[model samples]
Target chain A: MSQFVMPSLGADMEDGTLVEQLVAPGDPVQRGDVIAAVETQKGAIEIEAFEDGFLDRWLVPLGAKVPVGTPLAMIRTGDPPATPDIPQPKDPAVPPPPPETPQPAEPDLPPAVPEDPPLAPEPPAPPPEKMGTSHRQRVTPAARRRAAQTGFDLSALGGDRVISLDDVPSAPTADAPKPLSAMRQAIAAAMARSKREIPHYYLSDTIDLTAAEAFIASRNADLPPDARLLIAVLFIRATARAAQSFPEFNGYFEEEHFSPSAAAHVGMAINLRGGGLVAPALLDANEGNLETLMMRLRDLVMRVRKGRFKARELAEPTITVTSLGDRGVAGITGVIFPPQVAIVGIGTPGWQPMVIDGQLVARRVANITLAADHRVSDGHRGARFLRSIIDHLQQPEAL
Target chain B: MNDKDIRALMIRQLGQIAPDVPFDTVDPDADLRDEFDIDSMDFLTLITALGKELGLSMPETDYDQMRSFVGLQRYLSSHVT
Candidate 1:
């Protein structure tokens, strides 16, 4: 028996609206079968089933948006015609199904926080303009000065005697921090969960990208503007190459077991407009050349922005590669999105002074960081994985 | 086409390429990339849209000349007619 859960498209994607159901509850699902269309900020994506089974029952209804890892349906294994796309892990070892018990509406999630928490009735404090004058005697001289500078709402202050400078926050709390969108709330929850549950260990490597830069210029020189490749494609390809070698870093961690993926399914993290981000998989990242990868990247990003992508592209990412992409940030430390054990963060590349061949010279370089789950791979192996990426990047022509 | 209408055409493409960035604050002389946080994919999409709209062939070698609004306008002005 297997539980069909909502795949984590990105660490940030918390929930998706179930817009359409492709398969009925009783349908026999082949591996990689499209079961439903989920509406994310990236728009509607058809989600696929990773396991082959007799679709037992629908735990979630159409139009219901649920958190990632929530069991949408239960799949009964064995006695089904095998339409093999992915090999089964436990076929001969299939034991009798556990005694039937009802699954929850959602699992591994705390009670949903109301979009807007109940507000206290009209702030028991004095009126706005009245505070500066009437409460002027109650506030300390320094506090008054500080509050004025920060535009802090003096009316919100309470208690008998006086407010101190320490009481005045540097920022104006009077102006409420913009309420996070539903997607933002989901991102916050997912990140908090990743930090709490995953024993994340990080390592960063500064690699000279001089060779990659030259390779890019030479390649783009004769091509059309529409066909030119960017440095990011190299980063994604290198990450895929590294994950191909370091299989431990390229699979989901669930139920206290670590299963290595045969091929690297690289998640290309795309930042959505306004806010939030989604990292959908680019299947078989290691198989393509730089030009091929660039074309694939272009098509994926274009579709994602338009809000149309296939479900397998959203679900099957075993490892994710996130790039700052010329934003010019020095480096980034990523959080391990469960159950994927590893994430590769590519920072902005810039020319910097470095010693090479016993001489100080300027070299194009970037700092790449790896955030991996320690439960699956140690920092030592993680270092080796990052090293492979760095080396692959140094030889951009080969990749 | 007049420069103003051409600017609008380019902006229309940018609006599709990066739907979030505000063109009101954009510096015409500054690189579109720096002004709009436009990356390679956005850059490609922009060229593709403008090329399709104006029926111009922009080779990769000429991309540097089209990095800014003033430069792009000059390039398009010379090439379009």
Candidate 2:
């Protein structure tokens, strides 16, 4: 017997609601097949099976929000499907009563802390003037600040329970979409945890993309518009190769130990149409050529926009790359995602005057930044990694 | 087809790719990207849909010629059978 559990998609995710189940009991499933769709604060993600087996049963029901590592289903590996203990009634008129077996002692275990004393005082409730009727309403600190900042009536939330950050609107502008405060809090908490635990070092470089632009333009000249390549694919391909060479930056640092990943699964930060951003991995990125990476990147972007993602794409990113798409920002300094030691960021590529062999010439340049865990790699090695990416970008056809 | 019929078809096809685009307020002469903030993917989808709808083949180099509403119409008119 094997257990299929709810995978923690990212450092910030705690629980995910199972939106759907794509597999049924007794169905044979292969590894990498999408078996379920789990919805997190980020979006709806299609969860994949990690092993080949016959699904025995679903332990979690649809739309149930389960914590990370909570068993979602059971699979039978080597044995035949077990016959259910309780036999179904032959007559449709009479339904059989549920079995009266005693429950396990795990639920009866003592709580982590006694209920006698609280850890800290609850935050001061919102004032009556700020909130219409629910004066002493429970609200998160971030939500409280946002309410105060926007002057939004807390009573308008229409909930008697705790008002979370999701209740607060970033702005009252009619056209602006409601901010995804849950994703924001998740990001904040993870960033805080990363800052507290990982010693992060930052490196930035401006690379000339003249050769890459020409290469892409020629490459796409014959192809249709939908098949054209973007600079992002090049960046991801180069980063994957650089990570292959620099193994130190390509894995998890857990329990005060660094374990490098065998394959380079590069995560690309894709911004959703509605709001928040998600970094889903391109599996075995180092193995693919530019054409493969471009096709995969296109598919990944479309899936992300439509709220469809495989579990492996979410859970197995060894390193992350975030590009501010067409925003024209010169550079960006990124915060490290926890457990993973490194994150690479690429800013917009724009035309700039450059000195080529002492003669001034115009060139398109993009700034690349890397944030690495200091505990796993030093500034010297980090610089080399950045340099490797730069060299790869210059020879665009080779990528 | 006349210009009016071609314009209507173009709008319908563009809407298929970008449903949120405010066709009522869109300027035919202005750049679609500048006016609507359409990214590369959306632009590609719109171009592909137009090509398929009109039975025209548009190479990558001619993408700039199809940037605006009127530009796409002109390109399709010239290239279409």
Model 2, backbone clash pairs (residues 3+ apart or across chains), number: 0
Question: What's the lDDT for all of these models?
Answer: 0.78, 0.78
Docking quality (DockQ) of candidate 1: 0.55
**Which portions of model 2 show Cα errors greater than 4 Å?**
A79-180, B1-6, B9-18, B25-28
Worst 10 residues of 2 chain A by lDDT: A102-111
Where does model 1 exceed 4 Å of error? A1-16, A21-36, A48-179, B55-57
True contacts kept of each: 0.56, 0.47
Distance from true position, residue B24, model 2, in Å?
Answer: 3.4
TM-score of structure candidate 2? 0.77
Q: Give the C-alpha miss distance for residue A254 in model 2, angstroms.
A: 2.5
